[model samples]
Target: MGLENVWVATLTDGLIRADYIAGIETHQTPALTGKPSRWLLDVTLTVSAGSGTKDSWEVSHLHRTLAQTDVYPAQAAEELARRLHRLRRDGAAGVLRTYVRYEELSFEFSYFDAGEAAE
Candidate 1:
């Protein structure tokens, strides 16, 4: 099995926007690392202020889904809060959306005929 994809989306006013597809790297086979490649859904926001041209605003959301590493929900939540706080400090008010998508897909099986094993 493999982690199919990673998706980032926009959300505002209690509404979900279209998803943004993030490029992902897949392993030909699952590894024994004990971590399932998946994204943990998390969102964060940050705000900041400065003088002159240095003044800027930024909004950020933590994306855990589609990750090559496995993460617990608590850890993911912590990351989201941390990132969001940073973003909130870095920028102004803006609706930032962070999400994950699980698609319903089917798979096929294959078989082959071969001679009996030798002792």
Candidate 2:
């Protein structure tokens, strides 16, 4: 964990920011504040499970051109996929699945809604 180690999660209003930062060098630090409430899921998950259960996740979300192609609309991607299906029914989703493939020690984080699903 030493390639100038960086597994950062410094989001503001989208949660996950209680001074929680991994190895420094926060991508040229200049964010002086916080204001994010939605624009959910720019995710990329890949895990080809062997013992089964994860159902082999293969999600993708990347857009760096065409003005970011509407920047992930569609009701915030179905409300972040219904808050990731309520964190897979409150079992604490296995930290959002990842296999042994380390693409630069891949990192991304967010799941801030343990409410609004009581019906």
Candidate 3:
């Protein structure tokens, strides 16, 4: 595991970086000391326990990874967000839809809502 564990950068401090969301220009500057020169979503998929709300949706920045990473810190954060949501709704079956098929899904995920509207 010599080169495997070498962390070249820290993409995000938390699960979601609101600023670097799915739309409207994701974060340009990746934590860049450690891009694997490929698309392997650096961060491990840890679906944060919980779900959505009114003021906004507890959505993950996953969609962006498809392009951003290709153009993509964004790796893990994005993946984690998508995986969490699916797990919350679909369970292990969902996570398998993309990555890590049939891995014991963590029950940390619970609920989500659309958020209170504004006038």
How accurate locally is residue 53 in candidate 2, as Cα lDDT from 0 to 100? 48
What is the Å distance of residue 31 in model 1 from its true position? 28
Question: Tens digits of per-residue lDDT for model 3 on 3-105?
Answer: 1111112233323322233232234543466753333333322233345777665744243222224433334444546544444343221101122223221
| Backbone collisions counted per model | 21, 0, 12
Sort by lDDT, best first.
Answer: 3, 1, 2
Prediction RMSDs, each to the true structure: 19.3, 17.8, 17.0
Question: Best by lDDT, which number?
Answer: 3
- Model 2, 2-118: lDDT tens per residue? 111112132322222111212121111233458323222233222222333476655333211101121234343344344344544553322221111221122223333445332
**Inter-residue clash pairs, candidate 2:** none
Over 4 Å off, model 2? 1-72, 88-90, 97-119
Better of 1 and 3 by lDDT: 3
Worst 10 residues of 3 by lDDT: 1-10
TM-score for each model: 0.25, 0.20, 0.21
lDDT of 1 at 60: 43
* Ordered list by TM-score, greatest first: 1, 3, 2
Better of 1 and 2 by lDDT: 1
On residues 38-100, what C-alpha lDDT tens digit does candidate 1 reach at each position? 423423222222344457755444323323223333344444444444444543223334433
